[model samples]
Target: MLRETWAEIDPGCIADNLRAIRGMLPAGVKLMAVVKANGYGHGDLEAAEAARQAGADYLGVAFLEEALRLRAGGVELPILILTPIRPDQVELALARDLTLTVTGADWFRELRKRHASFAGRKLRVHVKADTGLGRIGFRTMAEWDALVPWLASPDIDVDGFYTHFATAGQVDTAYLERQARRFAKLMERSKASGIAIRHYHCAGSAAALRFPGLALDMVRIGAAMYGFHPARPAPPVELKPALSLHSTLMQVKRVRRGEYIGYDNAYRPDADEWIGTVPLGYADGWSQRMQGAAALVRGQRAQVVGKISMDQLMLRLPGPFTPGDRVTLIGRQGGERISFAELAAHIDGPAQAITTALTERVAKMYANAKEVRCPWNNAYFQQLRRVSDGSRAD
Candidate 1:
């Protein structure tokens, strides 16, 4: 029987991309693999495990739920929650041993009081100073300075200090340079106040490429490490595309003159012609606006026709066609290639449509085709091993 249509992710491609990213940094420069947004919609656990095996020093997620998912997947590497946790999540945060990012003195004080039992453990926390991003962070140097001394106490362990660049990825080099200068001054002021922190990082994917100085003690590599190059004068290094989408032709038929096709009579044949329908459409993350867009069929471009339905789309081929023929949606087809960025541009502008519209309807299978090892895969395996033999290997 044919399997349900799904997206096949290449863990090896992710591993290769991580290797390429690590090659660019200095020997001691730390690398925190940013796996937010479910590893950019590739499934976080699969991506996180591959990333750790490929030498990622740390894992960064946007919220507590994502971090918990990683830990549940047997990921023991330090996972940092990049977004601010509400006062309510402190107990959950403490229970999971997850690190929290603090932007204000009041927030830190409350976290310490909640974890009073683990006073000696020193709840791991990071400080966010607003250098110039004007986002969620300590807005002034005075705010950070006042908060630093409290951290010096035994209640907290300030593991890192960082900030975000407002326009690094979308602007020119000069804009990034100015942000770097402001960041440097902020670090200088923090040092002058005698506040010591372990890891200092601010450079994201774009800033890391443009300004190496921004990679102070660590760099949180996001989309770039996954083989995507954000906006820069030029990419700091070459990268690979880690994701590919595929489908198969379901049926092919000939239509009479002026015969309409699909819903709403959106497409009608000028004369007798052959049309092929593939099992993909808006419900599967293929936009309806791409009705006239193109796809790769037998190593050539074919125009889409009619309104895309929930589970199918029609394409007008040059001549006769057959079912089970390969269809390439976002991969190489001989000399022709269609990229996600290209698809996004065709449907809508970058901000609203492209990346954001790719829904989770596409199924994801691993390229290696290994059996997935989710919690349901086994019962009482690892903890039992740890208890009987005193070894923890799963």
Candidate 2:
């Protein structure tokens, strides 16, 4: 890439992470690789291909546009849109063979008004139960009751029923247990209605990794598939980070003790010090929130000394460095490393926020692309082979 700054994505690492997570799951349970937010900014198509090569059964995205992008990229896997698409977009989603997340009956009512039928095609859907997340989903029984009739329509297929846990990553499991119980009850109610829901799932990456019991028919793997996990009660399986950020020292100079640097005089050297300017800044997703964070230079930590600018940021170097010296913004350099968790902790946010915040201006250089290969002997792939062979039997 022309830009000196870039994110290195290892598709092999993503594949390995999925394989490890798959090993932790129960037999026959499916894995849905969540590639939302452009695979948490690691590149959606790359991540999906990696997941598919690792034998992922499904793919998940946050928006219709994202699903459409995947379809355009030649991804033939079943895709589920985690968020509700607009009623008007139902036909578009159907045309792409996309599964949708249905939260309430109102959305169905609106869709029916627009298109009385799905044009003889079964609209695959996953009904989302709020459980305890308080985000999206049908919470009350009345809401579920209102939704049942629409789900039972001849033109609709109840492909799945699921919910999200709010505190699955936390140490305390009380809230998570409650949410699980509520989801179980909801599933029981849905089953009592005689509607044949094909799959039942409620666990995302953290929950699925930590509690395999929560992995119902499928587990949605997102953050952990990229080596991000909960801080408390560490994950059982080891996962390698698939993404790393790097840049070069655009300029290096010796600043006098009294000389201020950056806009608004955000920093002043206490002593004559070596400073390096990196060709990346807030505009590239390295926001001002990372002002005091550290970068790796010459195998040592260099503090970000000034207010981050739109196109550049200054670092308090360990010593004098060349203009083109390599800077490790989020990766290992010699003996030093700057991890996504460290940066996320600095900003008091999720590790994913650190990666996903990275703007497109910073080029992505994918690594280990040739190493992504599926093991056909694995149970998951064996089952797929059997199904494929059976399909061609007649």
Candidate 3:
């Protein structure tokens, strides 16, 4: 709380990005905004509200805890837990009326064994069909086919069928196409079996923009909605970045020649250099490997030097600056600008990981919005009730 560092979130940008992504979808195809991982560390309730206001058909979260948080925030839209809920969490998912992801029959059988938690309340399910991602979901046609009979049970309501593409945004989509073919074949057979799944979604940001044909009934849009291209060779659609990270210089010091800086003497000044200490480090999600990443100081790019410490990092300031001078860590400043994508490239990681890995110490501020819409903590849900009785007090 003492640090003058915080992430500013632009709700308007989020709305605009979703609109742009929506425009690219084929007619009749809906958009399910993925607000998982605290909306990629941009603030979940804020992003979810913006996406809902922008006409998102569904909101996606990673686990039952996030779904419950959204439900408590009065998010009434169809919220689906993208990850398969733990066996112990199924009851809470059903209790919150949040859709659950069913990977295979064995997971479903485990749920059935604990049916007493259902308490006569029907749980909506989404069959996660794994075409090629190979992490989770129905791997083979036989696995998917075997679950069809159990899906007909009154215990669980199968409402949607979808898959995650391994490489939807890359220039080469050979594997993505193969996965799409597998998905189509499965869907065609499911249709022949008379299994009426409501929503069929594949394609995240990249797949949806590159292959609209992959859009059946809905597309789970995530990174694109936040203005980050899911793949390189940018698509034609317009996207406005919604988040910007900022920090301030805590101390400015002059380093003489031959002076070693940081752990392991990672940086040695060949000449006298003005080094500014920024009160952010790997613990703040900047990552120890992020040393040498650039930040904007005095409207100019300042190269990070030395190894990043747990609570601090050194920036080679363009000139000696005051302690309170604002530093743009991942945003625009004067004529110079930096972005999460650039930082990720410096570290050789996905841009999303940079944002999502940001720790809670960093504050999140909202812009282009009237008031903050924060989700209630567990304190608000101390008095949990059954779904049959109207779920949470929300």
Candidate 4:
């Protein structure tokens, strides 16, 4: 961590959040920890390990590369690629025992054309039904019917069927109910087909916590696992945020009244005031839109007073602050706290956007490495003998 600005991630908080969510779910229902986008920029491997420690049933990633990375890190929990993978990449996925998300029949046809048959293991897959999100997945019964035969192949296993809701986090329940009804109809169709789907899930973090009945077979917990509740009024479970950002004042100076600061004269001091520079800017995920947002300097709010530059931004300090003083960008300092929700409200986006936008240039420091360990004991792994065989399966 050469840079003074870094994100501090608490894996124990993530594990605790997962445990709380699990307690809310039904006994038979599973929890799919969504660790995509580098665990929403909290570090993919670390988040996955935290989920495993909390007894997560499955892991979800958005791409094949992400699943491969988790496998390389010795994550044995069943992994489902939330997005569809290329037909040519099927073998690579199969070799790693990765479950894929199938949207339509054409993907299977192309895969079959590439390889006459899968050689060793049954290709595990989850059928994606686009109830309302409209991002991907089969929308009509006809599309599902077309994709069923391909999924029924002996070499393939229909491990799960799932959908995503567009308005799960919104106050309005009308659209969410409509989408749930549509998904229910699709599930009936699937039942009639007798494809033997193992898991039927439609609820993400918000929907699962808001409506426990919607937790059909599994809930994909992403934002909630990171202590983000997208819904209003909050859910019953207690979730603590796992990540916080901090930096130090790189430079401090006094500016005269009416003197412009930063590029294009974005700001001018009303009087002789102290200005502090932080070594984080738009390039580190602090965009220009955050110009007027506040950062905590010595437990006091300091308004960002100038156009955020590529690598640094100036703040109107509450008073004179020395260089190397600690600045809280998204965390607690004394009695003042700058939360991700507060920052997201400024940007008018989901809390995760602020986290995922953090570029690799901003270093990440894990706070609790010892507490979040593998839940499985040595005897458990020894009995499975997977460790000796280098097989990632439980």
What total of clashing residue pairs does each candidate reach?
A: 2, 0, 0, 0
Worst 10 residues of 4 by lDDT: 385-394
TM-score pick, better of 3 and 4: 4
How many clashes does the backbone of model 3 have?
0
Model 4, 151-201: lDDT tens digits are: 889889999999999988888899999999999999999999979999999
TM-score of 2: 0.92
Pairs in clash, predicted candidate 3: none
lDDT of 3 by residue, 245-285 (tens): 77778888999999999999999989999999988988999
User: TM-score of each candidate?
Assistant: 0.84, 0.92, 0.91, 0.92
The window of 10 residues in a row where model 1 has the poorest summed lDDT is: 384-393
* lDDT per residue as tens, model 2, 24-107: 899999999999999998889999999999999999999999999999999999999999999999989999999999999899
Give lDDT for model 2. Answer: 0.87
What's every prediction's RMSD, in angstroms?
A: 8.5, 10.2, 8.9, 9.1
lDDT of 3: 0.80
User: Better model by lDDT, 1 or 4?
Assistant: 4
Cα lDDT computed for each candidate against the true fold: 0.73, 0.87, 0.80, 0.87
Off by over 4 Å in 2: 368-394
Off by over 4 Å in 4: 370-394
